[model samples]
Target: MTLNTRIEAAIDGALGRATAGSVPPKLAAALYHAVKPGGARIRPTISLSVALACGDDRPALADAAASAIELIHCASLVHDDMPCFDDAAIRRGKPSVHAKYGEALALLAGDSLIVLGFDVLGVAALENPARAGRLVGEMARFTGMPHGICAGQGWESEATIDLATYHRAKTGALFTAATRMGALAAGEDPEPWTELGARIGEAFQVADDLLDALQPEAVTGKPAGQDARLARPSAVTELGVAGAIKRLEDILSGAIASIPACPGEAMLAEMVRATAARLTPAHTATAAE
Candidate 1:
């Protein structure tokens, strides 16, 4: 099956299970709204890519892992757009979940997706118990506290912030999980894959920093100038536009260099390059020469 098709099927099945039964129609609609027509699907795509690169022994398990990662990501976006966080009105060019579904339902939907992510992995355990267990542990570590996205969120509430730590947890953790889990699912050692994911994650954040700084809501499909408005630390804020662009290039280079040996190494490298190209922001036409 095609990669996109595989991903969509996994996500569809998971969401269907959670929101099945017509008892709470609005909630189910809201859940579908939060996930349908997803943005990029980069995290899960990376997960599946790594699995392919490492000899996809258990594609079903990899699909579950990828789906779980994406569900968590979607959940985070739903919460992040709420009033308590970014307060974003638009996402993927549509009204944010809270805007469309109200705060209570949006909150509930996000929570439901988060739990469903693990449920997908748990179902996969029925086939391959050990690998499924490892995948769940990896997802938990990336989604929860101490060293995951939760830690990244916690950093926002602290008096002092460590830029690297915050960036890694907030953004890099899942990408890191993508690589590690992909390898683990493929029956390969996951440690060697960490640096590649970290570099790509860092590159992604830097690119996002640029888009958040320079791109319009029309182009970005979300609110612009968020970093400055929200007082969030950003590479664009720290390094300036040109400097941030340079940093993005550097991170992409490191990510390319960090790919571990595999039968599909060349194809994966090409995918990374293509992804980097997509992530790289074009210089605005109206900006100074």
Candidate 2:
């Protein structure tokens, strides 16, 4: 009934179907563990929110798109926590998939989720062929080589780094997909919504960077100081704590301003403001020190 309830149900249902069948028991179990007790469900919520704000023509399409984005996000996390990358032991307040399932199964489970994400998208596209094609293109660009999140991950190994490029791919790509798919779900042009998604995406990354800098494992539900530990490029690393907070505020304001006029504009604005406020460094200062 409520938006949050609907989104959670859809995500759970999708994850259920994704793990069904004769999946290797080990990997399937790993997949289940990886996606269970989902986090803020922000990506899907943002997608659906944009759709509702635009016009609630196709709630199903919005759900499908949201589920797909979340699947991809979860998959990325599974791989990100592998021994090669962050080598994190915990996520979502529990031992990570790799920790529970072993590296081989964890890798397979992450790959499976990536494929399943596209499968969810395909199902969504079946209902609206034209829009589905557009969504596929958008998602592919977001996940594929050269410019997608994959590229964003690869950037870490490079000698010189571009923080904007890394952030855009690592986080902004999905935000772009969420808003664009939301627009398409409402039978609207996605171009107009792109800037809003980009801003929110950047803001989300900035918040994440800030969290890495200031939040603790108890509040964040993930290992803290990862950015500094991994020496990963981050806004906070480039800009001090206060400067990063200022940048996050600027992005959040820009995101709210980018929404033209829509039925759910006010609600969307509230969500952005609330999220930004929650991520403020001042709120998490205790954790930082």
Candidate 3:
């Protein structure tokens, strides 16, 4: 199967097995709904890519780590789209969890997914205790308050913030986790892989910011202009369109350079270049026009 297809199948399978049995029917349905159908699956693909680059002996471990990362991402989306947060009515090209399942269930579903992410990671770690411990610690550090995505989300409430700090927490944290955890899952030292993820994560966030400024709801699958509307600090707001694209290119170049020569280096490089190109100003012109 293609890389994307493999990642999708792994995610679907993990979500299915996770939500099965003992979980309340309503909550299970909500969890499933949170991760349905399609997404770029970029985070998990990054995890799997890094794992393959290190070694492919434990695809299952990599899959578990990727699934856990995705669940956290999906859960974040559920909460982010709630009336309390972005108050967005749509997400992933459809009615958001709160819009479809009501505020209470949506909240619970997000909570459930967050807990499920830890659970999945716990199981993965058990099979390889030391590596698993490292993965858990990295994930916790990336997801917890004051330094992680949760803190990134919390930044919206702050009156003052910098673009780098904000984007690092909001988007880069999970991407960092995806790459690091993938390395850990493959029994590789995660330190070497950190820069690769950080660069890519920064690039991804810049692209996302550019998209928010230039793309439409139909294309982005989420409310566009929400960043500007909310006064959220973003690369586009801080650096304009052309400037943001330049920043993205610089970051992508750094990410490619960080990838060591390995079997999967080409694939990872391609993914980074493709992602960066997708974020360039020219690509946004058609969407803007």
TM-scores for all candidates? 0.97, 0.93, 0.92
Q: How close is candidate 3 to the true structure, as a TM-score?
A: 0.92
CA RMSD of all predictions: 1.4, 1.9, 2.1
Question: Cα deviation of 77 in candidate 3 (Å)?
Answer: 0.8
What are the runs in model 2 whose C-alpha is more than 4 Å off? 285-289
Q: Say which candidate scores most in TM-score.
A: 1
Candidates ranked, most accurate by TM-score first:
1, 2, 3
Model 2 lDDT at residue 46: 82
Decide which is better by lDDT, 2 or 3: 2
What lDDT would candidate 1 get against the real structure? 0.90
- Total clashing pairs for each candidate: 0, 0, 0
| lDDT values for all models | 0.90, 0.83, 0.82
lDDT string, candidate 2, 82-130, tens digits: 9998899999999999999899988998999899888887887778777
Q: Give the per-residue lDDT digits (tens) of candidate 3, residues 1-289.
A: 6667767777677677777778778777777788887587788878888888888677778887888888888989999898878998888898888988889999999988888788877877777677667777888898888788999989878788776787788889999898888888888888888888888898888888888998879988888899889877788888888787778778889999998666788888887777666556465755433
Candidates 1 and 3 compared by lDDT, better number: 1
Which pairs clash (backbone N, Cα, C closer than 3 Å) in model 3?
none
